[model samples]
Target chain A: MRRGFPVWAVYALGFVPAVVAFGGGLAGTTGPDPIRALEQTLGLWALRFLLAALCVTPLRRFFGVNLLRYRRALGLLCFYYASLHLLAFIGLDHSFDWAEITREILKRPYAFIGMACLLLLIPLAATSSNAMIKRLGAKNWTRLHRLVYPAALLAAAHFIFAVKSWPLEPLLYAGAAVALLAARLAPKRRPSLEQPHEA
Target chain B: MLIRVGTDLPIASSEITPRSLWLRRRDFLGAGAALGLGLTGVARAASPYSTDEKPNSRADITGYNNFYEFGTDKSDPAAKAGRLKTKPWTLRIDGLVDKPADYALEDFLKPFSTEERIYRMRCVEGWSMVIPWLGFPLAEAIKRAQPQASARYVAFETLVRPEEMPGQRSFPRIIPWPYREGLRLDEAMHPLTILATGLYGEPLPNQNGAPLRLVVPWKYGFKGIKSIVRMTLVAEQPKTSWNMIAPDEYGFFANVNPEVDHPRWSQATERRIGEGGLFAKRRPTLMFNGYESVASLYSGMDLRANF
Candidate 1:
């Protein structure tokens, strides 16, 4: 039990806020205007946490920080919160109006951005399983997961435009995503393995 | 007595109060208060403006707000405002005024008679709401303040603190703190403009600018700053939040004229809150939010540039 402290604690800590949000949502505590602001906040946080998770892999591989097992859990958590955010829109915000939903997806620019992000995640989540990864092969799986880069960008746009004013927060997230992507694309000098006999 | 279409008011200038005319038309229904009110309603039902009401575009006056001083979330004011100690509140009046005086919230509030006026509140975001605000004309308050001639503009300030407001805890400033707003002397004295202390017949929720907040009927909602901590009669233009952040997008006027669109989106249409029907219908947004009664005050100025 004591040995499980760190892992369980991380999971527990993350669950606290999500559980509070869920309870608050269920209790109808947010007065009349809850769904739009709540969904945007949760989606933004999920995207932020996902970016943090994505950074873990790069940090471990490039900077040699092997203590990165938490990334997988955090990534799954982001997907969990993001799924809730999508559910809130369809269930609460739109009340599952099929015709209205269709029109919104067609007419609203931000709606398309949100839809694209959620759609991209479905495949990513399906491929998250170790069994599905083995079936796809490691090389193919990595390429598929690269969709997260665009997904994050789309999610940020979904939030920025969702607001009537103050795009600073969304702009900051966009900047961070661009910087991370740039770092990943930066050319690295691979050390030649076969070296002549050194003195 | 011309009741012309596209005019600020439907009735002639002789009949200033539509409510009074409406009451007379309802006399046939009999004189009891409830029945009289219902009769007035029947008259409203028969009016051409009934269809133009664009009822669906109304916001839940309770929710359509962003008073960040109390908290960051839009709903925070409504939720966390119960904690605000409004009773025994005192307002200190000073600076460029003939009389520098301090008054308690209740004593100062008692003399002003309240009227319920439904005004369209347009957020810079494109969505809008029609709120039934219980307020008195701001001109009444300014008249009492009796500012000196040097006082050319009215400036308002919101209480500030990083600890109480989570938005302030962040590194990058998302919005200007002590959220300031201003109005030119003539604009501040517009007949339709109000100084609101309550809504839905109750003291305003702290998020909605409890104690006192200005409601410029013709301007975008943010111009109605909340949690007002101070009011000063100043000589120059005050630094407003949106203007300081992006001057190109937010002008000093920030009027609700559909003609002057925000750079990012069209203001020609709006979604009225609380009126359900997802993607209900689009109605032509009124210039100056149907407050042309006050628009002439800005006749010589360029609205496009001032917007």
Candidate 2:
């Protein structure tokens, strides 16, 4: 219904970053360590999409910018990027060695947390479609999607732990994730008697 | 060519630039171009100690680095290291040495002739590069200093310039600045150890430690401290930067042993630079990084425990 901000445009724009990230590596522009560049590019976009999706709720609550229609598209984009990140890790990084991948996911704290976040995202992504939403019912779908809150935290923690240093870059992302989560957790204003709901 | 191991083949005559002609050409290129070739001017020379395996491309060698003095990112060094000034450099030799005095880089380097030693440099982060470093053996300098009997270790320090090094100025410092590294007295005197002044037969690039850097081929690349300013002979083991930050993961020795893994990742293999695409299988890491000659340095000690 919101023609000012199109959900389809978000989907179209979301693919651009991924294309650029992969194209840079394929074209040898992603520096000497292209594996790291590509994986980081996909992973960062995943986290950014999650944060962008989180912003949709706040935008409507505070500024009365009812862009809630784009939330589903943003959430799906996050899932897609997260999936690609995982694929890069499992195949490109580890050479499709399932045993090594499993051992890493179990023993490495950062990898373990990152895998856990992806697992949580899977269910939400599976149920994002209208048919699955209808089958699961609105309340159940809403409850399932709330898993993103913890996933965001896990993603932030994974980013920090992977660096293994107190660098400013990872810390900045963690701070942004925490701030967005706090905004979502803030107590909601009671429906005002005088304030008419936007049609 | 393919990765040649355990072979020290002589370079073809075509590849070896006549030293006199090369020097004249370098003089003509001016100081800027003479420092390092811009991804195309890679120089090559044959040495008995040099491995036959191809050295990494100039771009990868310069662009991909772990010089945290510039910044933590691998590419940050190439981007920000241009600010470092290498002209009129001075190196101070002190702490338990007989002749403790400052020597200009030119005067200090005059005592010994530079050698072209193409060596494999392995980073603790699981990447590796075969770099051709040009410098004299570290023993030349250590012997010149005439260290006292009490001196059992060598401590090296990098210059601390907040104006030039943004990492030093960053709030919530990622590492304690004026980065430090050390080696045992014997390790410092080892023939494999050198004070690298240049790479690819060119003056060392700012990103790759301009004036002078240490090169211990048998150890992890971090142990080869960059942009050095001071060398101190000490009685006790000296504190190192990475060890100070994460003692559990980085040990004092920091030797390139594949058996002892880091806390977060395996060290059994490394991704060779300029090898292939992302999916290319990593080459298995070797003991002492294929410089098997250094194993005796830790003959009696347990590497796992030390690691």
RMSD of each: 10.3, 7.7
**Which pairs clash in model 2?**
none
Report the poorest 10 consecutive residues by lDDT, candidate 2 chain B. Answer: B1-10
Q: How do the candidates score on chain B by TM-score?
A: 0.78, 0.86
Model 2 stretches astray by more than 4 angstroms: A193-197, B1-45
For model 1, residues B1-307, the per-residue Cα lDDT tens digits are: 3312112334433255453453344355455445545555543333221122322221356654577654556665566556666555666656678876777666566667766556677777656676656678777777788899999888877766566556565545667686889888898887777888766445566667776878887899889977666777889888898798789879988998888877655677665555433323445578887777776888898899899
For residues B43-162, write the lDDT of model 2, one tens digit per residue. 333466777677887789999988888888889899999998877688999999999989877777776777778899999988899997888889989999999999999999999998
lDDT of 2 at B33: 59
Off by over 4 Å in 1: A1-199, B1-59, B161-171, B277-282
Indicate the residue-level lDDT of B105 in model 1. Answer: 60
TM-score of chain B as predicted in candidate 1 = 0.78
Local distance difference test, per candidate?
Answer: 0.68, 0.85
Evaluate model 1 with DockQ and give the value.
0.14
Q: What is the lDDT of residue B191 in candidate 2?
A: 89
Cα deviation of A145, candidate 2, in Å: 1.6
Model 2 Cα shift for residue A140 (angstroms): 1.9
Error of 2 at B93 (Å): 0.7
What local lDDT score does residue A84 receive in model 2, on the 0 to 100 scale?
97
